[model samples]
Target: MTIFTANPHLLSTLAPFICFIVTVICLLTSIKIMRRYRHKQVFIILICGLGTAAIPQLLNAYAASSLQAVPESLYIISTIAGTISFIIINFVFMKMYAIGIRIRIAPILLLSLGAAIAIAASFLLAPYEIGGTKALGFPVLDFYMFILIITMLVVTRHIEMPAAYFISLCVMFSYQIALMLHQYVFEHSQPWLGALVMALPVLYYFLLFYLLLEWIMERLLTTYQSAILDGLTGLYVRRHFQKKLAEMIARKPAAVIFCDIDNFKSLNDTKGHHAADQALQQVASILRDEVAPHGIAGRYGGEELLGAIEIDKVKPQTIAERIRARVEQETIVTVSVGFCTTKESAELASLVKLADEAMYYSKSTGKNKVTSYRSIPAAYKNKA
Candidate 1:
């Protein structure tokens, strides 16, 4: 066989092999991701795209490298289809991963559609006349690839994901741009230069997929963390704090304080819920400012708050009084506090009860007072 007869098919064969390897890697990675992270949306899209990718790669290989007869139309269709499919998969993957984060979906759709159109136009508008490159057979695939990169970058900026995904995408797009530049610079004398340059995008894509998966996992973890934090006060909520206290009990020392508003019902009835809410915010801020240095403060419920302080020697009454005084000075709305501590107590509910008793004791004496279980007068409790 002449060198010419053997050569034209070589590019086709190698392209399929490269694509197959990428497909298999993606398939295995998808399975691992589903098993490990259980990201059903991402896994399905990737798997479907990877599968679609395999058929084109195989067809391209057979048409180029093997003696088997295949239609040129099939090769062109596969190549275009593969590119479009991959771009769509990536766009959807990003949107799925950025659940809470806001993104502009309309642009992403337009960009991906533009890529599909560019690929279709390349084949449909090819020059019918002989030796005509400019009239209709102009190369438009590069433009599509460039636009795809730009759209992906724009989409990612709006979504909150790990830095690695962005970095990987940057690398992928940069490599594509460099490849395009390399082709433009050395189009003749080395046609294989184009293929080599193009190889970079494929290679970078493999890296990009893994980085995207990691970004999804990181985003999930961050979302979970946010769910446990109180939005208004920047503190762990009652449920989260209760869980933490349970864990702390199995380990070491802790203290608990429960606070309630003095005549808070009357305050809400008089000032409206909005003003009451503002007062609640003020109380939270004061507690955070005064007690958070030594502990954590959270709004337990309406007009009631709680604090957990870790102390080796400081008494619970001291922590309670510090918070009470600061809260009184911070707001026109006054609060009563009750506190209890035990280095060995594991049940937070027990401490909460003790603190509640002390708080009621303060209410009985007067509004805007801090009382501790240790300081409660026995006769004062009997009246209530």
Candidate 2:
């Protein structure tokens, strides 16, 4: 506290300088993300907001550092620019949320633009000189901020929001309150209060930066998931499954279970693709759930699912049977399950082939049953 008061001019100059630097960093980062991610329009608005906000900091820094008195008109311009920047930044937040929830934002945009224009015009048209130790438009800015906080609260109350978003809103509310107090109550009397007012924007911008990073990480994760997982069944795709199976076998003896839905083509032809897809999804879900703890489950192809389990952890035959029973009991269609353990063949291709042969045996003999590659009769297994 003493340090803040000891060098009020230095603290004031440093605070705005730091804020300007932070704003520029955030602006550059936003532009980079926008270009890299190709979110041109949203980032453009954000850049504009940051750019507007930076102006006041620049002006404040110059005013604090300069020996001569800065013109009142310049201070007026800074205040108006800062206010408009706040409006734009809040509008960007609302617009992002609206886009996410599929709500129309054109009305919000128009209203925000109108408010910004009105604030600017009102401040400019009013005849006010910088009276001794008095600032201009404190009441107008305070009223404007009050309205914004209330509107934002209403928006947040109705919609579900992330913790970061809620925290950012809280920061914004605190900033507005601090700003009002500093302008009216303290009137630059307390150095600590001035420091706090300047620092809050840095915190708010930092939170915004964190939010942007979170968004980028989420997008990357989504892209990776889509690449490795089946879009319909939520199981691993064939290529990724094979890669996982290879890794699993390299470590320990494993089992590969192949499951094909019984009469899937007939189901598709008779009940339509929708019914067929539902059956596939149901069967895949059962396979995925049952095998999840022990190992991996994936969609090998249409109506064909595969599961690989480390035999030391769980019995593949038991899992295969459970999958068959679940499909029969829970779904409109049943599955023929066949599994081959690594004891039979260590090669990946051979294990898959043996599992396929066993699945065919179950299919040809009866539908809705499980078959072990080791249990198939020699005569049936040898049949070309």
TM-score winner? 2
Per-residue lDDT value at 202 in model 1: 57
RMSD of each: 6.6, 3.8
Whole-model lDDT per candidate: 0.64, 0.76
Question: How good is model 1 by TM-score?
Answer: 0.68
Global lDDT of model 1: 0.64
Task: Give candidate 1 regions above 4 Å deviation.
Answer: 1-74, 97-117, 120-138, 151-169, 188-199, 206-219, 222-234, 237-240, 285-299, 343-348, 382-384
Screening candidate 1 with a backbone cut-off below 3 angstroms (N, C-alpha, C), the clashing residue pairs are 9-64
Candidate 2 — which pairs collide? none
lDDT at position 128, candidate 2: 29
Candidate 1, residues 206-295, lDDT tens digits: the string is: 665676557657767878868877776666788987776666555656777888878778888998888887777887777777666666
Deviation of model 1 at 300, angstroms: 3.8
**Which ranges of candidate 2 are over 4 A from the true structure?**
1-14, 61-70, 95-134, 190-192
